[model samples]
Target: MKNQFDQKWLDEVAVVALGCSLPGSYPSREALLDAAIGAIEAGDLKVVGRSSWWASAAWPDPTAPAYRNGVVLVETPLPASEILARLHRIETHFGRVRIDSNAPRTLDLDLIAQGRTVTEVGLVLPHPRAHERLFVMGPLAEISPEWRHPVSGRTAADLAAAATVGSDAAPDIAKT
Candidate 1:
């Protein structure tokens, strides 16, 4: 029999992005993250764990306000597309308006991955470029160091240390 059967448990894990630079309706990024987590918990998924919120200078424009970013692991039976849809809805509720490529937003939620599903035509798995960003990989590594990239088979910790983007990213010491 094939070994490493524990990997099967990851099938139900859905990774979520908690990123925000604008306060919007909330008083602070922490409040926004809290509200987003509450909304997520109200969905079909069950929030299981989370990573430390990391701070990074805004991308494409370092002069802009820094961003607070983190990840959450949820257990769900929902498919990748459905999970993405739900995340978008939560973003809408948080007053996120899509304009510029990486404009500051109250909340930005992305379904980084759901289990090991991978697709190119629709919602891409492993978030396509997430592995190259420290902001994403770092937090993910904090929670699931061994989270494997379905395509490359690399662990999150490895990816985080090797990330090409957000070199200044680090776990927010004040928040953590």
Candidate 2:
């Protein structure tokens, strides 16, 4: 029998990394992380790696509360759009209300990458800003040191290193 498969709904497995951060008082940093992990686990995403929490860099607002940031790597069968939607759902569950860009949020979940697939219209693959933010690169490098940017071909470690060199604004990452 010939293989029967639907190209439109085929499961596209991808190694996805999510950059999570929170700058709020309602849900503690640990609580936010636990909730995220719970959501990921509920979604049946296989947890491959995790990074230590770090303080957020002062961006868009230097006076904002110190944001705790981290990254999680998961092996998922969901497409990029579904993965992004799931992340948004989790954020909503955690009281994240998107009112403005760069606003102090209770939860911020960014879909940093989805394997090597590149799409720019609705969702940009290999996140456009991942290469520049140490907050994202630091944790990403810890979990996926060998992972390369699909567009730039630079390893996560390299990107993290570049983000830190001569940049006084780099986030202070604390080793836990």
Candidate 3:
């Protein structure tokens, strides 16, 4: 299920994965996401592709409010550290609190991967745990099914189907 976008430039630039989600309304998740995307676009990166917002139960706590999640593909020239710093700034600008881990926040931005680059230090590339989460892989598959994990070399669609985390994940019907 390849998306209808021309991804030929994928080889010409470094592709960075961006995961965005909102479990709490900060004037509506969609609005906040739009603004966040704009902010990302305003930076030194260029957003080349995106997945439609998907809805899923709050992980580890299904009783909590559902989350609207999506993945964006951006081309960047900055190092992985700077790219992560920019993401953190965007998350903070959107009212994201760092105290509670996974406790329903206004905005959550994650750097899932950056090209084939990998690091063992603080900021991990091709996110060490991303391969286990469908909420992340599902959207990644949606936009770039041909994407492959840098280490395992598995396609986005492959890891997405084999994903263990967030099995209940699915396309957001409310959006379509």
Candidate 4:
């Protein structure tokens, strides 16, 4: 039983990414990168691609401030549970809180997509709201502009354009 379980687990795959947002505890991109790189090095994950961008927050949460965010693409041969566990550990290490859905976080590591498979176990892939945020789109578009969402068949760019409901000047940030 143990050997069978181990082999099954090793056959899994996950889509992973590194995203940075501020008012985070860390200051510069390098600082965030250091933390991200550290996590990747410590885990059974593969670094596929990465991108970055900046956007002001929408008004519903007035207390929290604007955020500068980024995206990373990672490929992992670990089960979804293992991938999420690792990401959760990294987020906790970076001081992320889960008080609310859109609450501010120090370092956010989300599983954007996983091998074209759709799941609702404990996580969702092509992240349910991924297409709805510019920060996500800007970076994803940078890396996977033509990458189609398994459910919608729309490109990352299309989702960014459709879900954006606010007006803010694009910040001076490097995306990709």
Best by TM-score: 1
lDDT of 2 by residue, 24-77 (tens): 454466566656777877975766567666666446666755566767776776
Whole-model Cα lDDT of every candidate shown, in order: 0.83, 0.64, 0.74, 0.59
Best by lDDT: 1
Ranking by lDDT: 1, 3, 2, 4
Candidate 1, residues 61-119: lDDT per residue as tens digits? 98888899998888887777778888999999889999996888889988778787665
| RMSD score of candidate 1 (Å) | 4.1
Task: Write one digit per residue (lDDT tens) for candidate 4, span 80-173.
Answer: 6677788888887777788875665566777777666655587667677777766666556665566666678786657666656323524335
Provide the TM-score for each candidate, comma-separated: 0.92, 0.79, 0.87, 0.74
Q: Candidate 3's error at 14, in angstroms?
A: 5.7
Q: Which pairs of residues collide in candidate 4?
A: none
lDDT of 3 by residue, 45-112 (tens): 88878877777788788886777777888888887788888988988887788877777777787787
Answer with 2 or 3, whichever has the higher lDDT: 3
Off by over 4 Å in 1: 1-6, 119-121
lDDT of 1: 0.83
Candidate 4 lDDT score at position 61 = 70
